[model samples]
Target: MRREIIDYLKFLMGAPFIKGYRLIGETHLHIQYYSEFEEFKSDHPMSEYTKEEFDQYFNENDTLKKLLVGESVRLLRQFSYLECVTIEIKSYDRVVVEVHSSRFILNKYFGFNIEDLSLGDNTWKSMFVDVYLADPAKRNELYEKIVCKFNQ
Candidate 1:
C-alpha cells in the first residue's frame, strides 16, 4: 500500500499544481491549492510504514485500494494539519488520508466512520481530491468542472 500510494503521487510529477478543499466545519469549506507540489515535503515520511508490523497489516488486507488521479480519496487527519485528498487506483470506495497534527503526540485515525465526525473538530474534515493534468489543453476542462462543483 505504501509503494502504491507513492507511485500514484509520482504519476503527477509533471503536473503544475493540485487543488482541493479544507473543510473547516459544517458551514465552511476553504480552498487550498498548491504549486511546486513536487517540492512539498511529506511530514510523516513513508519510511514509517516500512516496519514489519505495518507490512504485515498491509499484506493481510486483500482489499486494500490503490489510488489514482482524479478520483475522490479520504485520509485520516492524524499526522499533519494539512487536509489532503487522494485518488485510488483500485478499491471499493475507501480513501484514507493521514495528516500530522501538532496538538497530539500519538497518531490517530479519522474517517473510519462518517457518522462519528463533528463539524467543530479542528483536527479532522472531509474533502475531495483533484490533480491538475500535466497537459495544458486538458487542464481547462478539469478546471471548469472544479469551479462548477466547488466555486459555486
Candidate 2:
C-alpha cells in the first residue's frame, strides 16, 4: 500500500517530477510534497507558518484554495528544490488513522532534504503538487491548477 500510495502521489507530479524527490500519501486521504513555492521562496519569505499552521491556513482560506484549484498553479515553476515534505490525514473515513508521517520526523530521522539542495543546478525543479499544497484535500480539489510544462 505504501508503494501504491507513493505511485499515486507521484502520478500527481506526472512527467514533470524529477527523480530523487518523493511523494507521500495514502489512497484519497492526504497528499503533499517537501518543496517551497517559488513565490514564497523567491524573496525568501521565511514562512512564519509551521506545517500544521500552514495546513490550517490553506484549509480555511477559500481564496487561496481557489487559486490553487484553478488555473494559477504555474507559479510553482519558480523554485529550485523542495526541502522536506509529508502528507497526513486530517480526516479519513476508510482506514483508521494511526501512523501518518510528519515532515519533521522525515527531516530529523530520514534526512529528508535538510541541506535544501537543488537536484541539478536548478534546471528543472520538482516542486509540483506536493510542495504547492498544505491541506491534502486542496491538492485533490485542485488538479486543474497544474500548468507547468514537463519539458525539463
Could you say which candidate leads in TM-score?
Answer: 2
Q: What lDDT does model 1 reach? A: 0.27
> For every candidate structure, what is the RMSD over all alpha carbons to the true structure, in angstroms?
16.5, 16.5
- lDDT against true structure, model 2: 0.32
Put down candidate 1 lDDT per residue, 1-152, tens digits, no spaces: 23333344333322222233444542222322232222222322442333343333223222111112222222322213323342211112222221221112212222243223334662123321222333334333433333212110
Candidate 2's TM-score reads: 0.21
Model 2 residue 88 distance off true place after TM-score fit, in angstroms: 7.0
Q: Judging by lDDT against the true structure, name the best candidate.
A: 2
Candidate 2 residue pairs in clash (backbone atoms < 3 Å): 33-130, 34-84, 34-85, 35-82
Query: How many pairs collide in each candidate, listed in order?
Result: 18, 4
Per-residue lDDT of 18-128 in model 2, one digit per residue for the tens?
A: 113233332123332223233233333564544454344333444334333321222112221322222211221222111232334333542343234344554223443
TM-score of 1: 0.20
| Residue 23 miss distance in model 2 (angstroms) | 16
Tell me each candidate's TM-score: 0.20, 0.21
